[model samples]
Target: MGRSREKEDAESRFNSPVSISVADSSVSLLKLISILIIFVVGVVIGLVSSSHIDRYFSFRADQFNIKNIYFAADQFSSDSEKMLVNCERECALSMESFIRPLNLNHRMTDDELFWRASMVPQKEEFPFKRVPKVAFMFMTRGPLPMMPLWDRFFSGQDVDKYSIYVHALPGFELNVSNSSVFYRRQIPSQHVEWGSVSLVDGEKRLLANALLDFSNERFVLLSESCIPIYNFQTVYKYLTRSVHSFVESYDNPSRYGRGRYNRRMKPDIRLTDWRKGSQWFEIHRTLAIKIVADTKYYKLFKKYCHPSCYPDEHYIPTYLHKFYGALNANRTVTYVDWSLMGPHPATFTAVNITEGFLQSLRNNGTLCSYNTEKTSVCYLFARKFDSSALEPLLNISSQVLGF
Candidate 1:
């Protein structure tokens, strides 16, 4: 009877609804706790990933700022270096100009100072900022007795149109002529012998000084005896606006031409290269720079071109012909009447100052390349006029020169 009672109790416990409900409640609670744990783990992982991304961007931003600062510092350093170099150049030019004068204000030895000045134009890299000016360089042995005529010619001209430089005899007195445009135009000069290196030296000196003025686009080497055949306006137009230079370059195979070439000047100046022409030259700035910067041919001419070889006539003509014949006119604008039976041209007296004579110089029916094309008209300047003819020239300046 005790065994039968225990069995009935066990079966009742298993069948009870209250007991089954408690067991189901425990299973649900355990599932909820497991979900909460998974949610908490997901939040921790997302927070760590976001923080890594933020740190990466912040590091990139700092690196970019550092590179920008370096670039700015480099640019500043480069600019400072350029400024220092420019300042040094200016200071050098100033000191050179002060110690050795290429100008007319002070006395100096010829050639070297002028040579240094000429190098500035060639060696320097400068920007062009102004229109061209003409340097009217007068190479005189003594006083310019015809100053009155030149003064009248230069007068009323635009001051910016031209400049003047005169190479006179050393220790020569200016006299009472200190009031004219040619007054303070005297540069330090040395004795110049016709047909010699010294003459070439003098010409180079004038060119060197003129080249200093960047605005001086044209260089006209005139003499104390030279007189302008046209007015200032006409001359200025011819030189400044013209394409070709007025340097008389000719191939003279006569006694003075091929005969003047020395074998020592073989490579630099061959016999076939020997040329002859007038000493006077109206050169463009391009040619002027070349002239001042010459070294090889110049030295050869100085050493070998002597005695019968007139360096003044041969040096420039040959050099231009050999290298720059295309740009040169083989004729001259300065008329010299070589028809006279002598080494010198016909000297004009006051009697020869007729208006007809002046007109003949303007157009002698000879054609030459003007501006760039050929034209029938001719001369613009004349030389070998006696100083006595100044009075008569002044008398006819207004009517004839078209002033």
Candidate 2:
């Protein structure tokens, strides 16, 4: 009986439920701790990853708010290396603070700036809000003597519809008040001798500077002496809706025409290819870019054509005739009287600025094709007005000129 009791006790100790429950509780506690540790680590990792993701998207949104981007490639020279650098830098900045105005204030050379401006996109459609603006490029000798007249013309017009660029003699500053429209609008200019290639260079420089702004759709070459004969609204509509660019291109076989052709311009520019036009031209943006990008023909003309050849009158007319004849209106939008038939046209003085004379100029009765329809109203601007004519122009501006 004693031996049977000993064996039963030993079996009972091995199969006790209390001992098994204690061991199971310890293992369950270990598993719970492990699971909680793993979940906490996962939560920490998720928080870090989500924070980084938010920052990345926020940075992108801030950087790329710009509506349009014009990436001028790095093919330009070292002097213009700032163009690409500035583009890259500006990408990091807010869209409101974009490219700096590339005008007289900038120190870039004409060659470098022209090369930089020539890098236009091949695509036709713009990716931004494009309000087409006319760029009035004034190639002047010094101060604009007729500032009051221009102020009247530009007054009460939409500021966004137009831009101004002045190419005055180097070191010349416009002597206008702070409220003047022409205040601080000059571009970097070189000395332009009359009837020389330098005159054409000034025009190209103005174009290059203006091209920096992509919104300028039309380019008008004017002088300090030039004045708008019509109101700003009329001029704006006339240019923006025109089917073709107004560039007076004609064949003058006389001494002034064929006599300017240089034989050295043979293979690229032929004698038959020679053309003549007024320096004051109104062209579309496409032609403006073409003029700035032209190196081959420009070099030929600059080297060979000078003195009596007058690159300002020939280079653009001949170049466009050869390449873009179909797009040209083949007429000038500026009026000048060559009735005296002198080397220079007639200059209108204060005495000449009359209501009758101005009306006669407006209605010259010469029928020309406007938008493929015959119209008598041809000129938009006139030049060679003396400083003394400003008062008369201002007095009759509202009634006669409708400014």
Candidate 3:
């Protein structure tokens, strides 16, 4: 009976739908707790990783925005620089066109020319580097026959120390090489008649042109017939060092002096104020500017001083005596022989260009003050040399003249 009852209990227990023991229940609870903990840990890790990823993408986006901004600024700056370059180029072209014209034939009137030349710097010192230069102004009727001799005289000299200006007849061009010093040195010219107001006009025109160059501190007037009696260095040193201008001015009672004075120049000019001089002159820049700026005196001479009056001979002398007498040395550096007793000076020919004759002229038995000391070296240049004398002069230029 006992065995049968135990078997029934076991069967009933098996049939009673999976009744669990205490140990089994404990194992199931532990597995459930572990699964819940693992799920919570996974959720927290996902939240933290997602936040880190978002921050990394945000930083990269900011870096890309900054690069785009810098690129745009660089493009704008490049465009601005190009525009500035174009503007500067255009301004430079405009300025160049205004300052320098294409043609050499400047057709400006004398009134305009003088007005332009008279414009001087008001300051005591010049704005630019000022190396004083001597201006040799040549007023010629036609082509220069003595250019070869002059070329030799000027060769190998410092170009900056001297300047050349030629005022030939209108429409005339000097046929010189580009390498020649006189090349392209011709200023605009007018028709100049001998012994007329036009002659004075031509001289003033040369002065006005020379005055345009601020570096020209001394001005010497010359003609095609004129020749330097000494070497260039000697002439330059003598002229530049002298305190007084070498303008041959003197008061004479003869008809050539006071007789040439016209009463029509009444209060402005008088016989007592009249004087005579050689036309060739070497004046300082101060006197040069004064000559160019003169209007009243020039007009009076133009109207009254005719052929017999000889404006070239009397006007500048009278003008200087009346105004700037102290500035002149009262003599000429250029030697002219009036011993032949004619209306004009003696015309030297080839035969006259001897070594002895030149030597006499150089030490012409006359005493004149040079830089306040009396000296026998009176003459620096001689004039009215015939074109035929050029060869003889050239022959003696090196040895006797020491040029």
Clashes in each model (backbone N, CA, C under 3 Å)? 0, 0, 0
Once superposed on the true structure, which residue ranges of model 1 sit more than 4 Å away at CA? 1-103, 106-111, 120-129, 176-179
Q: What TM-score would every model get versus the actual structure?
A: 0.72, 0.76, 0.74
Provide the lDDT at 15 for model 3.
Answer: 67
Error of 2 at 385 (Å): 0.4
Which sequence of candidate numbers ranks them by TM-score, best first?
2, 3, 1
lDDT of each: 0.80, 0.86, 0.85
Cα lDDT of model 1 by residue, 1-403, tens digit: 8999899998898779778898999999999999999999989999999999999999998999988866666566565455444545665657444433334553345556556665543345445345678889988888887778989998888877788888877788566465677756666677888868989998998888777666778988888889998999888888877788888887777776777778888887887788888987898988998888888888898999885788999899999999998888777878898997688889898999989988888877788878667876667788988999999999998998886
For every candidate structure, what is the RMSD over all alpha carbons to the true structure, in angstroms? Answer: 14.9, 10.2, 16.5
The RMSD (Cα, Å) of candidate 3 is 16.5
* The 10-residue segment with the lowest total lDDT in model 3: 95-104
Name the candidate that leads on TM-score: 2
Q: What's the ranking of the predictions by lDDT, best on top?
A: 2, 3, 1
